[model samples]
Structures are given as structure tokens and as C-alpha cells.
Target chain A: MATITTTRDGVPRAASQPTRGRPDRGFGTIGGYIGRTVLALFFAFPIIFMFASSLKPDNQIFADLSSLRAFLPVGDISMDNYKAVFDTVPAWRFLANSIGVSLLTVVLGVLVNSLAAFALSRMRWRGRGFVLAAIIATLVVPFETFALPLLWWVNKLPWLVMQNGQPMWTLGWLDSYQVQIIPFIANAFSIYLYYSYFSTIPKELDEAARIDGASWFRIYRSIIMPLAGPATATVAILTFLPAWNQFLWPLMAVQSENLRPVMVGVQYFFQLDVAWGPMMAYASLITIPVLALFLSFQRAFIGSIASSGVKG
Target chain B: MSRFMIERRGTAVLAGVATAALALSACGVASTSSGGSAGELTLWTHNAGNPAELGVINQIVADYNASQSKYTVKLQAFPQESYNDAVVAAATAKKLPCVLDADAPTVPNWAYAGYLTPLDLPQDLVSKQLKSTLGNYQGKLYSIGMYDAALGLFARKSALEAAGVRIATVDNPWTAQEFADALAKIKADGKYQYAFDLGTGDSGTEWWTYGYSPFLQSFGGDLIDRNGYKTAGGVLNGDAALKWASWFQGLVKNGYTPAKSSTDAFADFVNGKSAMVWSGIWHSGNLSKLGADGIVMPPPDFGNGPKIGGGSWQWAVSSTCGEKAAAMDYITFSLNKKYLAEMAEKQNVIPATEEAAAMVDGWQPGGAKRFFLDESAKYAMIRPPTPGYPFLTTTFAKAAQDIIAGGDPKTILDQAVSDIDADLKANNHYGF
Candidate 1:
């Protein structure tokens, strides 16, 4: 429904209904546009500099620093840095490993965290709150405070491996992808987010599903999970970011070059006479996946960040 | 009800399977074999990303493996930035490779911690090496590098001449007064943004100690009292140290140098932002790009003599290694004159031996960078050789940083001396 109005010129105007969550297009809207454009440029500047510097030679990268030329594709520009980056590190291998590790972490993290959250939020089990509180308490302790102890435990932990056509037990999870993925799968923050989201879904739906002879797990799978799409996406993203940008843990845990993530590959160019252009090119290459993910899920990503209180 | 029973039974079966799998894995863990077995030796290097150094080490490994079948030497290269942490972590896990490289200043600390075993190289090979290249801990040689690095005052002869400053030479480095007069003259000339660049922007802890501690020593103050390796009381905060600190702070106060230099000090020098730069020999290439006007001179004398920090990364055998003989064999094989020259050429550092210097092109007599070799041989003083050197470096770096940022020199140095003494006392004088 719309309201009709007559202007001074005697033409009828149809005033559209104000939609919920939409701000009126007033003078403040113009200010918002300007503010947004400035913010956009502020964030885009670093990426632009990286890409522009990636195209230029090392000396020119420094030479153009004093002027607007730094962010522009001016001067002698080429893909020489790309070639050098390819020569220096196993870019494809590192990227593939990172993608594999990050994807597995996200999928597993979502499943594990959601299940834990469902148990805590939906179930009426005893000591469930205590368990939740304990998990949440871990959020205060940084990973670095326990990294060494975790390393020792991981080294001592056992894993099943197929060796010489036989299932064999292996001691030390070092130099393997499982070590990188498994340790990060059970994140506390992801569990908390899932639990918070799960609590919003009506328990009557669960009651009705149970009355229809649906098991708790079945209800979780067929109803609640599908309803928690935004939370799942948020957890997947949150899980993907840290797992993708992992440096210290992977550096210490994985010894084989084939298991290294792209973040660690950044250090390959940081030698005596660091190849600045190549390093920038490599950074630009690795940043593509994250940018693509953000662009595809921009709305949900923004909402998640806003709700989760994550600044950047 | 039947379906619920079926699902519950299935869950039990799945849990059983998982338990069995974990048990099998546990059995395998129990039977894990000892490390360094099967005639294989693992050697770790801080050369990952550095293709030049990695290539040199790889060639040495290839030669060593081919020359003998007694043991196969496998090389694992880690990036230099994270290399020390990795080594420390590996040591904690008792998973250190048979052979590894340590930065020279940290060698004594590693040796004291039992992470490295003493080297037993032949007397002649040891004698041929530069004194700084040898990692001596409690009079035992534990590690040795293929090359060493020297720091110098990089200048443009034309810039100095225009400012009416005498060109400093190896035999006649600028004295304290002469250096000050030259900086003042250059600053008064107003031809450059600043008279000197002391590489202030690179605040890496090692750079602070490596670049500035030598100045402290030249002022007759050491990071620690070398006689007992017990204290820095008289040495670091003494009258000499205060003089060094005042002189260091005066440069920034008088505007002879910037309080914070550009990140790439050498780049600033080449851009003519500064007339001179206190930098390492690695910038020789960029300096050479200035043509014949480029000059590298020894650090200015601050009463005692001009000085530069000595030592670089050197190879050692881990104490936990079961293949010490094989590790030593590889280390010996890797230290050939040819490899040394190749490493120095690739890294643009000074070759550790006279023979290797002759073998390298730019290291020859009267070559462009021959002065660095001469300075390293003459003026380079190895950092305190006690296991406490790590704590000493960090403490000194903090104090010097504070002094440069306008903290009282006496108070800052006194605090540094207190911290160093406390750490040494905590570690029983670091096995002095």
C-alpha cells in the first residue's frame, strides 16, 4: 500500500511505505555515502598498495612512497614479482594445503561446535551449564599460554596410520595435516556462538518433533540446523580465518614443507635482501580466498561480526 | 521404539570401533623407535626462503651423501625469523635433529642448556677459521660459521668532501671528536636531511646489541664484566658507559641524526637523505651503485677503538643426537673452502678463512669490499661468550632504546646493569 500526495506542480506522487530496518534517504544519507566511501578507501588502500607494489620493482616500491604514485600502477610495472614469488616458494602447494586445512577445520568445527551447543542449549542434562561455563572459561586463556604444553601433548598423542598395508599406531602427530586441523576443530568461541544462536530457536519445535517420535539427533539434523544457517555460516567463517592465517602453530607442529600453510610462505621472501615485490605479490595471492569468501557472504559476515563483537 | 533401539545399537557399535582404532594407535605409539636410527642423520638449517644459502647447504648434503654410504644426511631448512623458537620447541620435545645451526651470540646459551655438543674438528681446520667464527663456550668449541659479518660507517666520499669532513679510512677512523665535528659540519651544510642514520627504525633486539654494543665496548664498557661474567655493574654503567650513552643521545638531541630513522637506512643513504649510515656489510651492493664515490669506513673510535659485533649463524651437533659422528662428518664436509666462498658470495658476507677470501671474487685483495674483511679481522669483537649473553643483549637493547628515547643515561644503564646481574644470579652466573 502507498500514500498518494500532490506536489505544488499538481502531479500525483506515490510515497512508498517505509520498510523496516531501512533508513530514510535524507541529508544524513549523503553524509553516510561520503562516510562509507571514505571508510571503503581507508580499508582498500593497503590492498591497493600491495597490488600496485606487487606490479612494480622493489626499488620503485620505495621510490614512490612519498607521492600518490605508491597506490597507483604507474612507473615500470610488470609481473616480474609474480614470477619471482613462484620461483621462491611452493605457492600452489602452500595454498592447497591451507585450503585443505582451513576447509576441514571449518566443516569439523561447525559440526563439533554445533553438536556441543545443541547438547548444552537444547538438552536438560545435569551439569550441562557447568560444562558450558568451563568451555567459556577457556576463552580468557590465550593459546600462546598453553601452546608449549599443547605441543608436548600432541607429540605424545597417538594416531592410527596405514603402514605397509597394515593399520599401525603412530606416536607424534608432527609433520602432518591432521595435527593442524584437529587441534583447531574444537574452538571455544565457535561453540559459544552456536550455543547463543541455538538458544533463540523455540524449544516447542523440539517438543513437537519429539512427540512425533523424532530423536534428539534427528531433530537437530532436520530442523534446528537448517534454521541456524546464519550461525553455521558465522562459525564456518570464524573458524576459517584463524585456521587460514595460522603461522606459529603450524611452524612448530609441521616440519615438512608440503604441510606448510601460505601464511608461513610469507617468510620465504624475508631473507637478506628481502624481495619486497615478490612478498607483496605472494600476499596478494593468498588474500584472494579470504576476499572472495567475504564478498560472497558480505551481509551475513557483517551481521556476524556485529553480533559477535569482533572489531576486525 | 524399534528404530530407537537400532540407532542406539549403531551408536554403541560406532563408539566401539573408535575405541578399537584409538587402542591400535596407542599400541603403535608404544613401539615408537628411537630417533637417529637406521643410519639417517637429520640436519636443520635456518635457511628456508633463502634459496642461496639453502642451495649451498643442499649441495653439501648431496656431496656428503654421495661420498659415503655410512649415513644419509637429510637437510630441513626453517625460516631465520622463527628458527630459534623452532629449535627451542624441538629441544623441549626431545626431537631436535642431529645437527642444527645457531646464531653465534646464542651458541653459548644453547651449549649451556645442553642443546649443543662440543665440536671435535681437527686442530688445523679450527686454526684456519676466523676466531669470531668459532663458537666457544667454556673453552670448548661447539659451533663454527662459514662466514662472518662486519658493520661499517657507509658514506659518500663526495658528500664528505663537500662538507669539508676528512674521509675516514681503515687505518685512520674518525675519532670521537672528529666524528662529532664531521656530523656537525654536515648538518650545518644542510645538503642532507640528517648527517647520519644509525639504523634506528629497525628495532629488532639483535640489531640494537649488534649495532650499538660495539660502541659501548669502544668506550671501554662491556655488556658484562668479561673477567667473571658475573655482573655489568662496573662495565655497562660505569663512567665509560655514561660517556657512550651521552654521545649516543647527543646525536639525536643535536639533530645530527633523526630520533627515528627510515626503515631501510641504506635506502635513505642512497637517496641522499643522510650523508652517512651505520650499517652492515650486506649493503655493499647498494653502496657500490653510487660508483667510486661510495666508501665504507670503520666505525668511529670512541676513546678505546672502533668496533663491530662478531659471529653469525654456525652449525652444531645437538646433545641428544645419537649420530654425532655422522653430524660432525657432514659439518666438516660442508665447511670446504669452495662452499665457504660460495656462501660468502651468495650472502655478501666476509669469508671466514683467508683461503676462502682469496677464492671469492669481491673478497680478494684490493677488491671493493676488502675493507670489510680487514675490519672484521682487526676491529670485530665477539659478544660476551657467556651463556648469559642472550639476557645481556636484551637488557642492553632496552637500555639503549630508553636512552635514545630521552631516558636519563645513568638511570637507564643502572637499570640494565641491575637486570643483567639479577638474571646472571638467577642462572648461577650462567655457568660462568
Candidate 2:
């Protein structure tokens, strides 16, 4: 989370007061409004286009973009596509699965990242820099390179193999919720995000808490975690949203229809005989929630960026 | 406000719930068989849901259940694309329902692995028709395409006329050379730029290999030597390879066709852009979407050539299939004379039996359907049921692209034989 006062052209802030006269502080100037309008459109266009396409009829969807006016078929405002989506794919089940995994990932990620970041920032641990560097170094190796080995290792954990004809180390983690969450549970980016914020969190607070006879764990649970809301919120949004949309790894992991999450289940929409109408409707159904959340909380997220002192 | 207590309570509750839910969601113990306890047998089908065909299949299953006291088949339909991947995963867990379907190609892989069970059939049925058409591995009948297939021409009629070529009769069907000329004409007239480009790389090679395997068979060359007594084609490079390589290269070099669509570019012909696509007879549904007016005919012969290519689909019981008798019963019911008629009427499939074809009552969709039947006596070449089909696809695919890439035709054919041998050698390792 890096906070900086963007140049006036970067984010369009509406005139604080609709122009009566020019203010002494260069407020509400023409340059300001033009900059604001241009910036707003950049973010809004993709969202607006997605919404419009969601409303489009299937036959017209494949038509040329230039013929958009003619493309939207004249028909009843139909929910058939949406209905078809529900009939074929278990949408609510996938949604529930996605929400469950994403929130779980967020909670676990925030704890692991913030605690590690807190210790590195405030405690006097030996080889602290080395530990942090080693952990951060993992970010260079792409997650996909480790995916197969990790999956196999977790699924057929050698310890789980009943070596003495008595089961020893049985994790039995294949195609499970843990399989989906564990690989992504402790994130490098989340730790880095927290570390950068925690470093700037006024060391005086930790010092005062220690003077009050607080233990390190107590300080973390009480003083540090409370003040790091802005960073936590930023991490939560970034981490959980991607987890919600993750399809491939989960698809590889879960085979049972009952176990499939929203992203994996929705893939059934593109059958060899996929009806174009239902396909669009199914796609729209899955994306709508994430898009809505982005729009509503976008301002709060922007504010968190500023407060995290990242740009400082 | 007790803010600390509230935050702590919320976090603890959330973490507790998450742990419980995750445990529940993660563990998957496939359900035990509800069959063999009585007459309940679970069946799985990968159907795109042609209601007429579905009705026929269901009716047969119903008849079997009615006729016997031992089994009631429970059918579950899956969308075709997900079925194979899902079934294989299920097979590992012993969760596959009694019946399954796959593309004509994959049945052999499953059979070779001993995942499938062979069904008892009248030797006459297996020998005269299917013994050669179904894919085999080592020395076993794994599966057979449920129907016969043949490569034919599908040309968007309006697109051809726009390019100033009107194909009036099947008798005037173009040759390998004439087909290239039409492609050139389509591009030159700007009606289309050789709209059908077979996908390049591995798949692109396969397109020419599969799509044009017939060329070799027509020219009296074979992909496998077949060793005469129950064997496949070609000791090494054969005349069929040269015939197809030359034709494929001519198309590639002329730049008359798109060099990059799909290994199977069935979509381009249906897109109303390509003047002609060399494809199987099932492309009617694809062409109908663009506009229903199109013509289908046999591939243009290069001087009264040999019947080079035909395709087949087969079915076999899986090892997991409980009550092999019931499974055989189901297959029998599905392939009974009435069900064969349903395939012809519903899928517009070529019949595997003369009796089935008679029942179809003008089942062919267009001139293409008629062309296939008219030439059934002349040039329908069935792909060899051997370990060699995949190798043939690979070898010819390379030859096809080399011709496009400006390689000498004869040399390209020679090189492909070696490449194919390398692949054959690799497959034999059976390394753990």
C-alpha cells in the first residue's frame, strides 16, 4: 500500500463546490475537471462494456462490434440464459465454495504475513534480514513451477503411506479444500505489503506497550494488529479477489461435482454443444459479484493506499 | 464500546467456522456402489442431447429393464467435453458408472491400459465389419466407433458463387489439383483468403495427416504395411505418403488455404468463408448456423484414385462395469436395428449396417450426405485399427507443413518415416 498525492490528472476529484468563482488555492479549475473526466472514463469503460455485454442477446454477441445497434436482438427481456446457467451448472454451490476458500485464504494470509512482518519490524531476532531475504527470494520462482510436485507430495505424503502396515503420516489432502488453500495460504506479496506498512507504524507505540509490561505476542494481538487495519484491508482485497477467480489449480485438484467450486463448475458451460446465450449468461453471473464489490469499495481502497505511507 | 472483545470474538468465530468448513469440503470419499445389492445399475452417458436419439437410447434401456428382473439401468448425462477428463479421474477411484463415451481416438488408450472390458459379440459382426475399423492395442479389441465416417467436401454455396465458381454436380467434383485451384480462385477473387488454414505445429500436421490420409489409400499407398495377415500399413515411407505430401505441400505453398485454423478446421467451412473444407460428414450442423445453403460431395479424385479414407466409432464395456451381462444387454439394445435408425436420423451418422441404412429413409442432410453414400462402393477407406494411427497423423502432419515450408516433397516423406519410427520406439519403452 503506497500512498501519494496523485497529480491532479491522475484521479478525478469533483469540484468541492460547483464553481462560483475561482478559489485562491487553484480549486475546481478547468484543467482539474478535464483531468478528472479523462481519468474516470479510463476505469469506467471496461466495467461499462462488461455490463452491456452481459445484457446482450447471444446471437448478436458474435456480431461485429461496429454493428452494436443492430446486434442487440429485439426480444423479450429474457432471463432464459440465466435460467439455463442455473440448470446446467451449480452456480450457488460454486459461489459458496469460492467465498469460503477466498475468505479462509484471506484470514490465514493476514495472520501469517502480519505476524512475520511484525516480528521482522519490531523484534530483535538474529539473522532477521537473512530470514526475510530467504522468504522474499521465493517470489522469484513462479508458483506454477512448484505446483505439480507440491500436489503430488501433499496427496501421497510418504508419511501417510502406512509404512509399517500401520499408517504413520497420513495427511490425505488430495482434491480437498486444504489443497486449494494451502498452496496459496501464505503469500509473499501479502507479507511484503504488511512489512512495508508495519515499518512506518510509529515505533513509539510498541515501546509504550512494552513499558506497560506487555509480552511480544500480546503486543501483536493488542497494539500492532489493531493499528494495521489499513494494510490488512489492502491485503484482504488483493489476496481474496484473485483466490475467488482461481480456476486452474482448483480444477486440477477437485474432481467430484459436489466438491467443485464456482470457477471450476462454471467451466461446464463451454460444452461441445454450448448454447451461446447461456454461456454469456453464465459468464456474467460469476463476474457480477466481484465487479460490484470493486465498484463499491474502490474509494475506501484508494484511501488505504494513501494512509499506508507506501509512497512516503 | 468493548472494541477489543468484539474484534477477538469475531475473529475466533470466523477461524473456527473456516477450519470446520474446510475440513468438510476437502475430504472426498467416493460413494460406495448402490448396485449388486439388488437390480440397480448406474450408467453414465456423454450425450449432447439430440432428444430423438436420447429417446431411442432411453427406450432401449427401459425395454431391457422391463424385459429382465435383474437390473434397472440408471442413466446420467454429462456434457461431452468434461466427460473424458472426469471419467478418467473417476476410473482411478473406481467411481465410473457402467457406460462411457469418447472420441473415436481415445478408446484405444483406455483399452490398452486394461481399464476396459471386452464384450462378447457374434464373431460374424466383429469379423466382417468391426475387426478392422475399431482401434486395437497390442492384440486386443478395446473399442469401436459406433458408426462409420467418411471425409467429404463441404462448400458454402453462396461464398463459392461470390468467387464466380458454381459447383452444379457431384460428378464434376474437383481433384487434388482442382481443389487447390478453387482455393486459389477464392483468394484471388477476394471472396475469401483460403479461409480454411489447418492448425500448425503438432495439430496442423495432424490435419493433413488425418484429413488427407485418404489420399495415400486412394493412390494405393498405406500408412501401415498391415503385413497382409491381420497387420497394418507401410514398412517405411510408402507411395501414399508421397501422394498426400505432394498435395498437402501444394496447398501449403500455394497459400490458397489459411495456414493456421485447427488441426481439424471444421469450423472454417461452417463460417461461410471457406470455399471448401475437406472434412467428415457431420459438419452439417456447423454449416447450418451460417445459413443452410451449402453443398457436400466426395473429395475430388486425382484421376480415378483408390478409396483412401474412412473413419469409425466403437464402444466397449469398462472393467468397472458391474454385470457384464447387463452392460452387454444395454449395448445390444442401443445398437439394435431401431437404435441404428435413430443414429442416422438424429446424428445423421453413416450406418454401420445395410439394414440400418435402409431404415434411415433419406437420412443424409445435403448433397454431401448423398455423395458419401454414392461413393460408399468406390472410395471409403477405414483407418487401420492398429498402434499406427497416431503415428500416421504425426508423420503426415509434418510432411504437410514441410511442403508449405518449401521442402522437397520426396525428402519430406522420407524424413517423416524416421520421425514416426522414433515415436513408435518411444511408445514401446513403457517406462515407469
Give DockQ per model, in order: 0.43, 0.14
Output the number of the TM-score-best candidate. 1
- Model 1, TM vs. native: 0.94
Candidate 1 stretches greater than 4 Å from native: A1-21, A305-312, B2-36
lDDT of 2 by residue, A1-312 (tens): 223232221221223424357465565577788899999887875555444545555444434234444334443437777777777777788788888888899899989889889888889979999988988899799866776566556655322233445434434365477777877878877887788777766676678888887878999999777766667777888887879888656655554455566776555654433355666666677777777766765765665677554421
Q: Positional deviation of B419 in candidate 2, in angstroms?
A: 4.7
Which residue pairs collide in model 1, if any? none
- Per-model TM values vs. the true structure: 0.94, 0.70
